[model samples]
Target: MTDRHASAHWEGDGKTGKGTITTQSSVLDNNPYGFNTRFENEPGTNPEELIAAAHASCFTMALAFQLQEAGLKATALDTKSVVTLVKDGDGFKVTKSALTLTAKIPGIDQAKFDELTGNAKTGCPISKVLNAEITLQATLDQG
Candidate 1:
């Protein structure tokens, strides 16, 4: 099956501008930019949040695939990606992305898990796209 998704339009100057982000099922209305400073320093969806979401989702899926390839079933996979936008001389840039992951898998040893996680960190599409530093911390849950 082929699935497709889309988001609506955005315009304006960014810092003193305004726009809206719409998806297939949701619409972030009247998103503005000014004082709050994440998304244009006021109100709106910023790039960092988007990047975090993308990285988190991509990493989780990559880990799942890695586990399956290793003849193991992944019962649960949770990942959090923190994107840090820091001042780069004169402008702000995404300097790093820290990915924290917790997974539940039966019969997977620590060494194997660590190796798979490392491979997934490099194999994930988002991780491949960003030049920012990528760090991973993985916890394997045994029950």
Candidate 2:
């Protein structure tokens, strides 16, 4: 099994608090995120956006491998994940994650493309980890 790590440090209360996030790869070294950034749409990264990024990247990679496994060569894959956070009781919870994708794979049928896309969406590690509702919308470019 492999392990990855990310950490956050905060100062003060929720609304006015400020924090920095750090990742194992140091890609997000001292990256700022807080209540304002999350709820107020301030100029900083938010947890939901991070989740979206993870979902998008993970789903795309899984689809690539699935395509290869099916003897299909991938010309391109463009994916987007949108995460929705909503109020739950006194706090908040992520309610949904929607993934949209467009792919270019030569000599592939819609049924097969859809089957692989569904497999990737269901098989992606991030998708498995998420507790929210996950949905996928896919387009296969035929040429």
Predicted candidate 1 versus true structure: per-residue lDDT over 26-67, tens digit per residue: 554444433244744454666687789989999999988998
Q: What is the Cα-based TM-score of model 2?
A: 0.96
RMSD of each: 3.2, 0.9
What candidate 2 gets wrong by more than 4 Å, as runs, is none
lDDT of each: 0.82, 0.95
Q: What TM-score would you give candidate 1 relative to the actual structure?
A: 0.81
For model 1, the stretches where C-alpha displacement exceeds 4 angstroms are 1-12, 23-44
**Top-scoring candidate (lDDT):** 2
Give Cα distance to truth, residue 10, candidate 1, Å.
4.1
lDDT for each residue of candidate 2 in 9-122, tens digit (9 for 90 to 100)? 999998888999999999999999998889888888999999999999999999999999999988999999999999899999999999999999998999999899999999
TM-score of each: 0.81, 0.96
- lDDT (Cα, 0-100) at 25 in candidate 2: 100
Candidate maximizing TM-score:
2
